[model samples]
Target: MGEELKVIVFSLAHEQYGVEVEKVRTIERMQPLTRVPKTPAFVKGVINLRGVVVPVIDLRGRFGLPEADYTDNSRIIIVAVKDMEVGMIVDMANDVVDVDSDNIEQPPEIVGGIKAKYLRGLAKLQDDRLLVLLNLEEVLNKSEIVQLEQFGE
Candidate 1:
């Protein structure tokens, strides 16, 4: 049997995206955010979750997609990479699936408007569905991680 990788799949702008389950700390419902000025446009702001003020980023803006209104399906995916935690606003928090490592293929130049560097690979699933596995470290730059850490301090 091929090595298995568990992923937390989420939807953004109608495209399916996945992040390693280990990197996903929690999945939360949409919550009010405190907007911080002079930050990157993609950085939606911060949210207070259980006494921890976490920085939130809109995946739509981070991936260069047009912003849409937050609907009932909207959710915040709190992911931790290298000791930094940030909330990623996604259209939906879909499924938790196990993907075969061998089934994951190299990503092309781009996938759904996001650069290849930000992606780990593509997993081919049932019914011709594709999961864009994300390299969380690459998805959130070092500076952004540092900024998020400051919020926690």
Candidate 2:
């Protein structure tokens, strides 16, 4: 078998999910956000990170899931999509995990109503839990990023 792909897994609602570790820039606690008007409801707002205004998106809302109350575990996952850096909020951030290619299954048609096009794959961990691996590029497409930039302009 080929080398396992290491991923940074997280939790949203009651399900586990992951993204390639290489795509993740950092993980931070939920911070105060500045609301942006006329954007998608999933686009929560923006935050000034070290003088850089990073747009924040609520992953739960994007996936059409019910809004979750922020707890101590809530986090903002900073990821680089193409040349732009964006922040996505999740219910909780889990640890880095390794999964072999053989164990990575194709995403099912129905994943909490998430479109298959947005997913990379589904990873099954040793604990019998499933992690919905995300295709960062697909999840945060160029058009959406461009829209965000337009909003800032």
Q: For this target, which candidate reaches the highest lDDT against the unseen true structure?
A: 1
lDDT of 2 by residue, 83-114 (tens): 78789999999899899888888988878788
Instruction: Give the range of the ten consecutive residues with the poorest summed lDDT in model 1.
Output: 143-152
- Model 2, residue 62: C-alpha shift (Å): 0.6
lDDT of each: 0.89, 0.87
Query: What TM-scores do the predictions have?
Result: 0.95, 0.94
TM-score of 1: 0.95
Pick out the ten consecutive residues of candidate 2 with the lowest summed lDDT: 144-153
lDDT of 1 at 107: 97
Model 1 regions lying over 4 Å from their true place: none
